[model samples]
Target: MFKYVIQLILGFLTLLMSTAISWYEGSGIIDNPLEWKYSTPFSQIFNIEISSGQDISQLDYFVYAAKFQPFFPTIMTVSVLYICTVLIFFIFQLNRQLAIILSGIISCVFIVMSAIFFNSSTVGGNIFFWITAVGALIFISMGISLWYRKKYMFKFQPQ
Candidate 1:
């Protein structure tokens, strides 16, 4: 019971940090107008100057940039992944095999979602991006560690 509670608390903490960092990174792009050109959702939110004499309308820019932008999609996917992982942890508490499988699914989804940012030149260097990735990894590590202990490391006390 104690171990389960500890694991649950830690898992929640990891997810919370991941979600917070993802949002932080997403919001940081708006700090610079030029950076917003790479994010359609952000472009739609704010008008950005392209050059000394030229400016782009958010809608017009979004129409051109939407097909290539992954920033918003990654944030949404990670949020959903966080919710699903938390549910898996709570619902599969008694089934180690089920928990492990679900954790793998959750980890894979996060990996793919995170992969969306690899091609992004701006996102790769953001501190919040690294923090978010680390937080998600911690969540996966906690789940795997719990599953391993339950499957192979259980101890029996002498009577």
Candidate 2:
């Protein structure tokens, strides 16, 4: 009974973590002008400059850039991939600690970096692009390790 209870708790926690991760992601953020006012600890983490006169509408969150843009999308993609991969492992009932540790690591990096740049009080601060980029790099590192282990293992996926 105790073991089952622990498993249940673990599963729920994992799901909750996944849910939170999903929420901050691109699909999660409800492109609201209000989200612009979040004044978070990681506010000024992203530094974007408005082009000469490009009138940016609220719905333009998917924008890459006006002057130097490709960087933002590339970083955001990392967050998506990291969270999606973690979700996949979770759904498969793989190692819970592995998933949690990996996810936490990603989360921590963003949190720390975000705190350092907190409260930019600028238009670009509304977008949390740096966190996303850092997240992707972290994910890529873990993914590579998993891939190498699988490729070299004589007996992968131990039962």
Candidate 3:
């Protein structure tokens, strides 16, 4: 439908905007070696030593932004999730049961992600933890509302 297309376009645009902003913000770390320790989680995890900006890959910029300055990266992640959710809802609009199941599964995944970030020491980790927790709640509510509407609000009446 036209509305679905609009929502999809808006979600994609939001994702692009967030990615660009996060990339710009993350690129700052390339100039400031002092921030390297805080920004190079990928390098640390992989045991890769980054002596200069060249040692950092383009993909690492996004990772840096995600760990150190998560606002826009979070937006990017949520936007991608929203686009996927919208597509799933559209695809399963006629199958309420399947939609409900998928919603529950998605919520569970978000819950786990939130828990993973729950004890993070960085500002970005704290923010992502709360965001993912909220996402889980949203998905749970969506499933409940769909189930309620299908079960209680659409009952047939005798003519």
Candidate 4:
């Protein structure tokens, strides 16, 4: 029971961390030793963009700035969330599974909302948003399925 609780907390944290994915757009790159930008000031100082083509397309530049930490935050958050999500599937209690499944639904809702704007947005924004949104949507769908199995598809008897 305690393990399940810990796993549930981790799962919730993962959901919260998922928002970090938004940070990738503004991920800054470096040109020369003196020339660089980053999602954060610290990233720029420690991370160097050595790519020959230092300039992103005008559209990509705008989108990247609009986002941030592409190389860091987004991946980190989603990764944490995914890890917790997997734990939730294998270990959480039925009631907690309900919350996790609901969270997945919420993620799906977020993606749908994003899709509405992505259609009218820039090419880069459109692509990134759609892919991430879809990923979130799929995760939620899978979670919901797992929850369904835990709830209605199985019967638990006391030992």
In terms of lDDT, the best-performing candidate is 3
Tens digit per residue, CA lDDT, model 1, 99-134:
777776666655654565345455332423453465
Q: Which ten residues in a row have the lowest lDDT in candidate 3?
A: 150-159
lDDT for residue 13 in candidate 1, whole number 0-100: 66
* Winner of 2 and 4 under lDDT: 4
**Candidate 2 residue lDDT tens string, 1-159:** 454456556655555654444333422223333333342212234443333222223233333121123344434444355445546355324654465456556656666645644564433443444554455456556555555554566575578
Comparison by lDDT, 3 against 4, better one: 3
TM-score of each: 0.44, 0.30, 0.78, 0.42
Q: Rank the candidates by TM-score, best first.
A: 3, 1, 4, 2
Full-model lDDT for every candidate = 0.53, 0.44, 0.84, 0.51
Residue-level lDDT tens digits of model 3 in 93-136: 67888888888988999999899789988888888889889989
Q: Give model 4's TM-score versus the native structure.
A: 0.42
Summarize candidate 4's per-residue lDDT along 99-130 as a digit string, tens digits: 56656765776577566547644454454566
Clashing pairs in 3: none
Model 4: CA > 4 A from native: 1-63, 66-77, 80-84, 94-97, 120-123, 152-159
Instruction: Sort the candidates on lDDT, descending order.
Output: 3, 1, 4, 2
The residue pairs in collision within model 2 are none
Model 3 — TM-score against the truth? 0.78
1 or 3, greater by lDDT: 3
User: Which candidate should be chosen as best, given TM-score against the real structure?
Assistant: 3
